[model samples]
Target: MDLRALTLLAGANSSGKSSVMQPLLLLKQTLHEDRYDPGPLKLDGPNVVFTDAGQFISQVAVGQRPRFEVSLGVGKDRGRLLYEPSAAGVTLSETGVSVGQAPEIIMRDGSVVSARETAVLLELPGLEAEGKNSIASRHGIAHEIPLVPWVSIAVVDGVLLKGSVEFPAVGWKTHLSNDLMRLIHLGGHRGNPSRRYPRSVSSSDLRPGVFHEQAAGVIAHWKQHDPASLDALQSAMRTVGLGWSIEPVDLDATAIDLRIGRTRETSRAARDLVSIADVGFGVSQSLPVLVALIDAKPGQLVYIEQPEIHLHPRAQVGVADLIVEASRRGARVVIETHSEIILTRIQYHVAKGTLPPKDVLVHWFACDPKTGDTTVTAVEPDAAGAFGDWPVDFAEVGERVDREYIEAAWKRQSGEAG
Candidate 1:
């Protein structure tokens, strides 16, 4: 799938929306654990776990090979990893790497044959000597050779690579790798509401699906080091009509308490603090999402599943606005949601020109009744935020219910009058 600056996945349960995210999460976990070599892809990890190959693969046909492919990057500077199920593990079948604005270097199966072919196709001079030396050095065929500064060769075993390559003056390899490494995902089932949170050292990287457990610690760390971030989070909460500020109360060095202070005008004192559990459930449910978005740094990709959960319709729209603000601040945001309010808010933002239409993408997933396969259709919005051909049965259940109630009420009134 082609991901834009902001992508929204909307569909029914088991319609394959989460299926798109599972493989990427698996890859992220594998890369994070540094276990991407000499094995089939690791199915069980800290972030996610699968029992076996049967559970991981879909649409199984007897005697047919099971495989998955992931393609990333943009334009000529792109990479693709192909995998096949193996008894020992998931094995990497092949890899395709392209760099430079014009496809200068190509590596397939950890060999430089594609590079030589690319050189021949482009008719680049001095490639025969430079390409051979680079490939020899990468494969350990040569200990030392005069290397070309513009061209570099690298090898991959499975999905792991040992070295870095530079694309002339571009340095696309490092840039692309860094982008991939910055991916962050928050699962649908987030941390539950608790009275006290543990005080632990904050890591530079946020853990997937554990934002709730880390919220208090991250808040305390930022409160001490980066007060502006805390202020931003408070501002977002206010925007969502929460009208409360969050503070971390140290129970001791080992644990901290999260206290919510009233921010709205009231007869009581403004400094009065209450435990998060004492407040509405939506407050605790949305705290992590607000903190994550406001804390996002530039060029980071943030994935949030069901941000609208436990929120009122108005609050859901407010969360949508927060997502847009996060995107505007230079972070890429992807969300999966079932709330029509959130979708309507997004359309409003696009139509009012608060956000560019091209940067927003909406995908509607549906399952084929006969084949039991999932199909995705792109729902495009124009400059006016109007979508042509809305997806079938998208948020129509409420209207149907209302219609049924009105019909029954009319029949009862007619029978009584007769």
Candidate 2:
């Protein structure tokens, strides 16, 4: 749930790892200019496609009208909005809004105060003023807002049942733009390699393409203007054991050939470059991931799904190095994966003090098949890099497979002896 650094989303097949990530993508697609006037939420888009609202709202949940909240936070400050499915998209209103200009609103001992003259009580929309104490707990903490000229003094009695600010709070917008808006998603299949990938110019400096269609052009961009960055990307490919260094050759004014060459074991033949299509699927699927991680600026978010897919076990472990490298470079890395090889290699780095355990987060998700409710648990690792709270289900299948193999081998040996 901490999207600031290295986070691993691991769980059962239907346990909602991707579900937690969807909201971020939902926000990304909404901001994407490619989709004409994508509303507050684009239900079906390139980042994540959905035909109906039912895919989002669960029937098993017992709420009269279930809604999902997309929360934004930076450091200790936070803002959240709740939305329900509306037609092909979603609908949301300004729930509770509080604006404080003096600085930050401080909350302590069930009393809220500000050193400055003004404190805006978050007024929840549509709720009539009634009980004060009972309604307080549902509200978000006193959030810091941008300096605005207009404000009136107000107070609510209850614990603040999820209030929304009226102006949408410029501070939250800036924070979102810095984090989720700048996020690069290398999820799902990155597409098959080709002889020439059409070049694309990115629309905004803040937002990269959610589908990552600009990766080839980005490589080409770096080659012409930022050779140092391109070198870093090539270094990353080696770190991931992909070993094939990338060369961007402009085919014409509108296209480029992303050639791959082997330079890991330097030789005369290593200098020869071939079309990316000549390499197998593994390199193609992972090229975007390396590109995102290496090219991301500090404080940007980069999310990848199954970073180890279509790779040998050794190469999978090398991906751990790349993830750690990207994180160390000040880019946040969020990965949804089932690759135990990559996970264990991360642990190895932590144990060797190459990475701090505090910098890494592992979330284990499990869903109740009958109820369809999902629960997430943080699997914490000790200083020794041992996950003491590792779930039984996580290890169960592996142990069972090992036991079955041993038993089968013993039976075969006994039959041969007889």
Per-residue lDDT tens digits for candidate 2, residues 223-328, read 8888998998887787676655788888898999988877655574346787888877788888887787777777888888888888888778777788888898
Clashes of 1: 2
Candidate 1, poorest ten consecutive residues by summed lDDT: 140-149
Task: Compute each candidate's TM-score over C-alphas.
Answer: 0.82, 0.79
* Local accuracy by lDDT, each model: 0.69, 0.67
The lDDT of model 1 is 0.69
- Choose the strongest candidate by lDDT: 1
Give candidate 2's total backbone clashes: 17
Residue 6, model 1, lDDT:
82
